[model samples]
Target chain A: MWDTFILNPMINALLMLYDFLGNNFVLAIAVFTILIRLLTLPLNLRQQRSSMKMQEMQPQIQAIQKKYKDNPQKMQEEFQKIGYNPAESLAGCLPLLIQMPILIGLYRAIIIVLGSTPQSLFELTARVYDYINLTDLLPISNKFLWLNLAQPDPLFVLPVLVFGTMFLQQKLMTPATKKQESKGKKQQDDNPMAGMTQSMQWTMPIMFGFFSLQFQAGLSIYFVLSNIIGIGQGYYMRRSMAQLKEEQATKKPAVIKAESETAVASPPQQSKQDDAALDAAMKGTPEERKQYQPRKRTSKRKRRRR
Target chain B: MYAAKRPLRRPVIFLLIIASYLFVACGVQTANTNWPGLSTDGEKVYVAYGPEVVAYDVESQSKTWSFPAETNPTLQFFAAPSVQDGRIILGDFGASGGMLSPGVVVTLYALNDTDQGVPGSIWTNGELVSDRVVAPPLQVGDQLFVGTANNFIMSIDATTGAKQWEFEVGHSIWGQPAYKEGVLYLSSLDKSIYALEAETGQELWQTELSGALASSPVVNTDLVYVASFDNQLHALDIQTGQEKWAASAQDWIWDAPAFADGVVYFVDIQGNVYAVDGASGDQIWSQQLNLPVQTSPVVVGETVYIASGDDLDAENPQGALTALNVADGKQQWQKTAPGPLFTTPVVVGDSIIVALQSDQDLLIAFDLETGGQNWDYLPPQE
Candidate 1:
């Protein structure tokens, strides 16, 4: 079902465009990139929503940490007052995991089939290159300026572009945290990427750049255009998520106490009520805190960008 | 909890594998390992190309006397021609090649004479279905012995193309039948060497080898030399096809074996050409060509000719036909042409005609002594 309904249809559609465009392989790759990015828009929006929610809950989370600064056990308890799970941030990258084959398959399509190297492809292997119209974008030549759409660029332009766009897309799509959690070196070791998720975001582009070195120029073009579209999509979804966060301001604060820096300030009249609730949460079993506590607004903000 | 992730990872891995295989499977024929045609004496030259038969003047460096495969369906050269008794015989291997699956029975044709492009049909002879009768009928007196791709080594009357005898092998036969005295030496993909009674089609004896034999077995009195894909040149007893001796090489030895004086000359696909003592199967000298050498070695008296292809690239594309001194393995002279070459060299009368190929898609003839252009007849440069 997955192959027929999603992958093959998409593959055949790209091929049809390649055929229709007179085998213009470059345009086919560009159109394919645009189509896939557009298809995943909804899922991208949801991830961004989650991230936005997480970001909005940050102020309240900061207050909770200050309140129990010296007591390690209390800080952990106070953190439970507003929910924050670092592992949950990784969930925002789920769409990439789902789209991995499409990305890699398209890369391979450009190399093994379209922009073939004589030394690598062996004889006795059945080859069908007619399926793609690589010649149509004629004057667009697989060679543009210094780029050889056929082989990986030796000048490293394509790969660097791939790397730069990937990092930028990661930045624009992943919600930035207002505060960096600094524990002792021990805490840093416990979560190896303590603040490095953002680093990994940039690292993805660099890694993709290396892949570009061995892959074809047509694939690099796809990746660059895809990231460009993704950035635009992220900004649009971010605005929508910001509107949702504004509406939620009327409701009870939704934030993990440790993450709340501004939302920690509740009305003074409601302080006694909040303190009583905090005492109930403190007395309650850990599982009870997990079940009753609301999701952080910052998590939603994180989700929004995701 | 991780067990749930296992199935999820499986699909990702499976999709990745499928994608990689697809990438490897889709490339085009960006370059030709070669385009081998026949020399004048009806011998297949070079490597990989089949139907190893040629005539001195008719064949170009290209695979066909005419355009091999034409987009125009109506323009078919149904006449497959070869020479016997100074006449060119023609016939079909009784099947369709290229895109179609051919039938089992093949038909053949014979020619007597030609002046320029005009030909006088010497005789019309039909014998069963034998597609690859590439080597002109070896007309030893009256018996015309030839090999066919349809798995038969048949002898026909030199005058009428009537079947005189037939010998069957284990698998389909593609190499030309090498003849000397009353014995006909034949090679088969079945990995067996056969010494057949030239007159009766009776197998004198057969010796099985380790690899498939593709080149026609060249006989020098008591020793029979055959090149096999098994990477070894085998010298068997001429009378019984028994192992006389063998020397292993580093690459696929597809070049036809040639014997002169006491030395044997052969070329490997890696461009290594060798001279070995025919009496002892010991290497005397070895030399490498500029690019891969797939052309079978042809020796006439003191001169041995072999063809070499150039490094196929967007620029500086060319190929060569080299003639060497048989005794010392030193090059006498060479002929260079543009693009990849697979045509074997055939020495006939005053002209050492080499059907050389050009990027212009024409078959050119070069003077044997001077290496100058002799004849340029083909379509314009493609």
Candidate 2:
């Protein structure tokens, strides 16, 4: 099932890419990596959006946890009120989990396509689709820029690059623990997810970098290119999220001032509750967020005209 | 509490990743160890499959001797051993420094053919090359010509295991070097056929074909017949390396064509066997078996034997030895084996010996005239 559905399709697609892409295998790999990343963009965006939403609701979540420590059902109800699903937060790992199969499949595909041995070439004959003129394509060019794609890189350049790029991507994808940074060790103690993500940020890159040391340079090319693309996607997502937060903050000053004025008239404990509620409202629904986005766009256009 | 359990998640995932990597790595490593390389010297047939190289006596149908006596896990032999005058020469695929070293070093060993069932090394070329030797070393009198996977053709003294001369090609040479009248002919995966001086390893002439040649060139007195991945069998001029005529096949012609009595017989990877006139690349007769045949056709007298296997990755992988009339391409008889018969069968006396990919029967002997199985032998795995 794996071979027919995932591996064979991937192998043929790579071969097709190699055929039309002027036989420049490295270029083919780069383009294919970008294409695959684009295909999985929706999943990545969903994961990123979920993570951002979870990050935004962190303070409110902590408040609920502290208040409803004695009432488990009430804590669950409060989490729902803040539009936070713990299950959805766990599903944030889904995008990476889905990518695992793609990585494994592409690894096998690269090994077969850039096969340096006869037996591997022989096995490739069986894996190739009938329409492909494998006779001409026999012995896919493994050479590119002093690197034999079939073998591991000797200069140690790729491994280091893989480590650096993967580390950067992981850093970007990992939700910044602003609360944890401010609160220090106590915040880390309170939120296990922060600790897990931090550990993963280092561990994942180191693990893949070690893998790149042994794996074929072609696979390392895939890793490096994939990580670079991920970095771009991560940068875009973080920028958009930051813009959205900025727009929300900019549009909410008048409402926040009005609430603060009403809170000053009310009791002290009510003022604190109102302030927390205002913060939750600031991290509002997609509808509320989209309303402020147009104003930021208009302001940018006005600045451009100037 | 969640924080305590969270640390365990990464360790579990890391273990899974490591396990998956090991599994994939192990599978890929076993996929292309270059099948069993079989060769014969009229009296004994040598089989080099995995860790050991063993020789089987043709007449007695028993083991004559095996080199090293014990299998080394690191060292693997896949190239056919060149047996000549009580000396056997072969090269290991490679052995690395296990976990510490990243480089693989291949060694060439010259062993004395002994009466004691275990051959001793005459001279060992320890780490002579950094790449694997996929092509069998061709023994020409005192010098041995070897082709490596890393695009190097080496000439080593057969007696002392000393380097004679080394020539680098454009790509890997998977076919054994062919020698004729002090001139060496080699087909490379670089899509070119190279002619080199046997004594000096100097390039004489090179002929670029349409596609890569994985099989050795069959050189007669006049022409060098090269089967290539271009789906064509090219006849090149022996002296100048100019293409004379080419015969097309359905798929890649992976092995050297057999030349006997002015006729050249070869099989494509798609199992199409064709007989062509050696002088002119005209097809005389063609037969379709519809199975993958990577081994060269062995023509003894009037019968041509071809070994074929169907889908090595299949659940019940099967192979056969089919004997056909050399004149008409008519089927004489066919015998099936338990596993894929990848190596070309070697004819000795009245029986033809074939190497199988199965563990149950590593080597099988069949009657040359009749389709009856003579005997089957499996070497010691230890």
In lDDT terms, which candidate is top? 2
Writing each residue's lDDT as its tens digit, candidate 1 over A102-150 gives 7755654454433221112211112223453322221122444655564
lDDT values of the candidates? 0.56, 0.80
- Candidate 2, superposed: residue stretches over 4 Å from native: A56-75, A183-186, A253-306, B6-31, B63-75, B115-118, B123-127, B380-382
| Candidate 2 C-alpha lDDT tens digits along B1-382 | 3334656876776785675455333322322366899998888899998888888887887888876676666678899999999889988876643442333557889998875557888898866676778898899898888898778998888999889889988788899989999999999998999999898988999999888899899998899999999889999999999889999998889999999999999999989999999999999999998889999999989999999988856899999999999999999988899999888889888889899888789988899889798888987554
Worst 10-residue stretch by lDDT in candidate 1 chain A? A117-126
- DockQ of each candidate relative to the true complex: 0.02, 0.19
Once superposed on the true structure, which residue ranges of model 1 sit more than 4 Å away at CA? A1-306, B1-36, B39-81, B93-105, B122-127, B130-137, B300-302, B310-317, B349-351, B357-361, B370-375, B379-382
Per-residue lDDT of candidate 2, residues A1-306 (tens digit): 999888889888899999998888898899889989998999999998888777555545655554555788987976786577889988988988999999889988887787666777887888899899876775677778978787667677887899899999988886767444364443443455665666667777776766666677898999899999989988988798778757866888764343223211111112355445544554787444222210001233456999
Candidate 2 TM-score, C-alpha based: 0.85
Among all windows of ten consecutive residues in candidate 2 chain A, which has the lowest summed lDDT?
Answer: A289-298
Residue-level lDDT for B285 in candidate 2: 99
Looking at candidate 1 chain B, the ten consecutive residues that score lowest on lDDT are B95-104
Q: Compose the digit string of candidate 1's lDDT tens values, residues B137-249.
A: 45567676666543567787767768888887754454667888877888876688898878788888899887766567888889899987677899998877788788777
